[model samples]
Target: MRYLSVLLLSLLPLLAQAVEVGERLAPWTLLDQFDQAYSLDDQTRTLLVARGMDGAKLVKEALQDRPKGYLEARHTVFVADIQRMPALIAKMFAIPAMRDYNYRVLLDRDARVATRYAGAEDKVLWLQLDNGRLVAQQEYATAAALREALEKAPH
Candidate 1:
């Protein structure tokens, strides 16, 4: 029992260090607004995470005028954590509204994936990855700034 306890204690630090740069992110799959499953893989170059409604609005505004495949062309994925929203609201309004979006919105229903990365609640967290390994991270609080960054990012 003592050995087991010691082993578990040692693993705590590893669990706490979620989504760190210079490390590979564990692969995950989540359903999008259209109920299509998307998975993190080597081809995913950028991950845009929004933990709250404001952050999600930033992403929405940034992509409002863009074409349907804009993010996909850049090998980018946008994840929105909707776990805090009430189930009734999500089903009756949120998810339904999301279906009209031009770009894909990966829904983090339980926040399991979004919680792994650390960032401000109102800012969009941008994770730059190379073949599944984290290379850089940035946070955008403005839709214009996020739009500019996305435009400047390589395809």
Candidate 2:
């Protein structure tokens, strides 16, 4: 019983940051891959948050065909959560890639923002928000499914 209690207590902080459906996302400010400032306020009418590397890769793969202008025109924001990476590695590879990358990739450095949306790692969290209020969320098992959903979603 004592061990269970301790375990539960240890998870309390994680539980506190969970983002629920139908709730407005908590305000967040993070850096883009280029190390530029990107905030929740800077997001679009529809936001797609990828929780970890797998999620980011999925999101990238799903949107492979779309050009930067198309994404910008659609008012869609793609956030890449890189909080799981070591600080040194992030500084080395992750941050530097942004300099040449065309698309915007928001780097959730501490992952606090990502944890607020999804506690798990390596899964994409598709969140559609309007004026900062969450309207929908779903987990995709395949890139094709995610692509179809994004194609069908209201822009």
Clashing pairs in 2: none
Q: lDDT tens digits, residues 23-116, model 1? A: 9999899999889999999999999999999999999999987998999999999999999999999999999999999999999999889988
* Per-candidate clash tally: 0, 0
Give the Cα lDDT of each candidate.
Answer: 0.93, 0.72
Which 10-residue window in model 2 sums to the lowest lDDT? 114-123
Pairs that clash in candidate 1: none
Show where candidate 2 strays beyond 4 Å.
Answer: 1-10, 98-100
TM-score against truth, every candidate: 0.89, 0.80
The residue-by-residue lDDT of candidate 2 on 56-86, one tens digit each, is 7777778777766555666776777777789
Error of 2 at 48 (Å): 1.8
Clashes of 2: 0
